[model samples]
Target: MSSTLSRVRAAYARVEAVGRPEIWIDLRPREETEAEARAIDERVAAGERLPLAGRLFAAKGNIDVRGLPTTAGCPAYAYEPAADAPVVARLRAAGALVLGTTNLDQFATGLVGTRSPYGAVRNAIDPSRISGGSSSGSAVAVALGIVDFALGTDTAGSGRIPAAFNGIVGLKPTRGLVPTAGVVPACASIDCVTVFARTLAEAEQALSHAAAGPEHALPPLPRRRPGPWRVAVPPIGQLGELDEGWVAAYEAAVARLTAAGASVRTLDLTPFTEAAAMLYEGAFVAERYTAVGPFVDKLISSGGEGLDPTVAGIITRARDIPAHRLFADQERLADLRARALAELSDADALLLPTAPGHPTLAEVAADPLGANARLGRFTNSTNLFDLAAVAVPAGEVNGLPFGVMLIGPAFTDERLAAIARSLEPRVRLAVLGAHLTGQPLNSQLLAQGAVLDGTTTTAPAYRFHALRTDPPKPGLVHVGGGGAAIETEVWTLPAEGLGRLLASLPRPMTLGTVELADGTTAAGFLCEPDALTDAEDITRYGGWRAFLAGAEDSAPSGVRGTARSAPTHPHAPLGDHPTDE
Candidate 1:
């Protein structure tokens, strides 16, 4: 077997060993797989190469892939298209083999993966929990290593929530970045084709292959210069219904960015939240109806034989919306979009929780609409206001994964990706501090591209100290000569890349050579002694984690109340997803 096939077969073996068969609706037939392998073999013989040569991928059933039936999770609505969606065609042209269509929430109306006739897509980490939807299968497929990457569609939180739940990267490109010419639409004007992958590099690789090109010509995307990116976080008052665990996760995520030398600040999200509400509660429901009205009507007329009840209910709600109401919603949305644009006019990107909280399958089924609405709390407004987003898995909270999303204005997709690439944490750093997993600032390291280099402790002589600042920062200043051995871990970053990163540091913090207990020197963060005069020293608490533990103990119950609850009608201020002639 070729190396790619060997790898794929190995991955498949693991999948079979796990006995998680529902992760895919179907797989490419053996003949098709062998044919693709042979084609790659021939290319190698001919000395021709492609970016995605021999890579395997799956598409959400809502996106047409020629011979696969486009089900949108409703067999009654299935259609066999003669051609692939533009995005799918591009990937295949780049030498990616389409594995087959995967499952989704029926009609892409729900966020919980179980709202389909097909079996629920279980979380890769914990099957009892949800694999978020309607991109559920897509995320699960990648998380389980079934495919290198997969194609999904994001209408509200379909693309992002699933990625967050499954601990993968979901890149929801700017609206129109990947044409939606052949995908089954949920909200046509707001629909976005998304990619799910195990790593940021893999996700970007998929994006680069699928991004915009003309029907007849492919022009390179415009390149831009990089600098210290200004990232905006929603003011604490705007964070709705987040638990202590998620709050810690977000704080840690921010510290990572700050440590990476990026400027992080808070901004009001009233305008953005208002715009998000209109997506479902406002007239956008009409757009969903418009896209599949005939199919839905026929399905209903035929006694709802193949339609998922939840989807049928959601689409049927559209029948009552009046044209005048839609116009009013449009006017409202225009004003909200303007305000949101004004708020974000200066920042390079905005960051927020991928979802306020993750709900279980039972919670979703018991109150499908409310549960799904909550998942889209921060996501619905993106396309309505014309923005691109990348959801990066930050870390876990109480064994559940927590994610943070970075968003940018439309067409700034590439820049946003670059920024995310820089912020992802490294593994080497996590091992050095006894911080390990679930520690404060650990997520920050991960955000910066730190992968775990396995665990180890400090050498025979070293001391650790926690410097007090408003948010509290960590310092490892060596006391020299007779200092005791400290327990710590090590993380690695590309040398040239680390230098470029260190050069961007701001005041009060500096990168310096530090002596480990083992008498080895490594680059680590240090605070100028003068800067610590007013800072509280918590070295007795050991590393950042111990300090954070105490902070959590003293944290007030009302601190979480500080975040604004997502308004019931998030899109109320913004009107709806815009429809064009």
Candidate 2:
């Protein structure tokens, strides 16, 4: 079989194994999708350079996929679309085959997946929990690994909440970055075409392909700082009644960002919360009525056969919102946007829990509207303020996935991606002695393809010691009180490389997270408490290089530790260590 054929077959098998029938509302026939993939393989064989060649994707039901009927989760409301939506067409043109159209909340109205006639889309990780909505199925499909990436729409958290629930990456580009021409808009002004995938790079890749449609590109926001990025996080009190576990998960994610080299500042999230309320409470919701008030009214009058009661209530209620009230809401939103923007003026992005909490199916069933509203706490205001966002899985809580989102002002999509990339699995190593430049073990790091990030010092809470080894080595130990800052170098490499380096590590030295003077932490060398028993305390020397220099100055001419005067190598004046010492 051809590569595309093989991949398509494997995907079909995985889809069947997942057994979540609600994930897809409309599936293109297996033969038809395979035919499309086969054509792409043929084109590649004929020398085409399709970026998404052989990749598979699913479009949310609200998004037209040419062959599938656009059902915004209500059969009576669905229609035969004349063509693929602009975003969908772009991905297809890039050689991505559409697997089908996925289920979602009716008319993309609620953040809870239960608001769908097709069926409630259950969480991929915990079936008894809500999967989030209105981009519900698209997020789960990606999370389940059924598709390489999937398309969803974001307007008041539809895109991000689902990704958070499913433990995947959901990237919401600037409002107009990806055209929504053929989508059944929840609110035209706020609707954004988004992509969900298993990694930041995959989501970014899909956005790059989808955004290249018919000239919708905008200038990206410039980075804020020249050194380590600055990220703002909301104060815990402002996060509502978030579960302790979720809050701890959010804090841990922020710490990871800090440990990966970001300066974090506590931010007041009041402006953001106030703006988010306007999405469903203020006249801004009138846009939903404007989008499909007539059809919903027709259904309501005929006993609302196809309309979700909650969705109908929300849409119908906004029908009589005075035009002046909308203008007032717009003005208020402008004020909040100004405040939120000011708070983020010097930061690359704002990081927060993707949702205040994860609700189980029973909780959502008992209080659908309330549960849905809570899920949008950190997501709704994003579109209202015209910000770009990327939601990513941030470890798990109680075996269920937890997530954090990075939100930035409009046109900061690329910058958000860069910040999110820090959350990936790469590891940073802090080398204090043997692994420093010009040192004996420096070759091992270079051999593993590690790159020297920069030179720095440990926090003033570590003691430096000289281990009594064949070739003396230094050991770093955390001493809560009487420690002093010690010189060190930080190097970055893939996680696999770090594991390989650890495999051959000698006795007395082990790896642990080292606190740096700048408040960041990195994996570095440390000695066992027992190894410190007979080790010489070299704390006063401040560093191995300085101690070696002092020893050379006072030693006899033939002393083993003695070396010629520092070499002309400008990279290291004193030389962290002599290669043969």
Best by TM-score: 2
lDDT of each: 0.72, 0.82
Per-prediction CA RMSD (Å): 16.0, 12.0
* TM-score for predicted model 2 compared with the true structure: 0.75
What is candidate 2's lDDT per residue for 1-581, written digit by digit as tens?
67567778878999899899999999889999888878998997898767677678899999987877888888988789888888888888888788999999999998888888888899999999989889999999988978878999999888889998888889999999999889998999889989998766567667888999446776755544578988998888888898658888888888899998999998889999998888898998998988999999998788888778888899999999999999998999999999999999888899988888988999988998888888888899998898999998788899888888999988888888878867756778888887777875675564343567777778889888888876788888899799888877787755645775676566667878999878999988887888878889988787778777765223111112322222211111011222211
Query: Candidate 1: lDDT over CA atoms?
Result: 0.72
Candidate 2: where is the Cα deviation over 4 Å?
A: 220-225, 427-581
TM-scores for candidates 1 onward, in order:
0.73, 0.75
In model 2, state the lDDT of residue 448. Answer: 40
How does residue 126 of candidate 2 score in lDDT?
A: 94
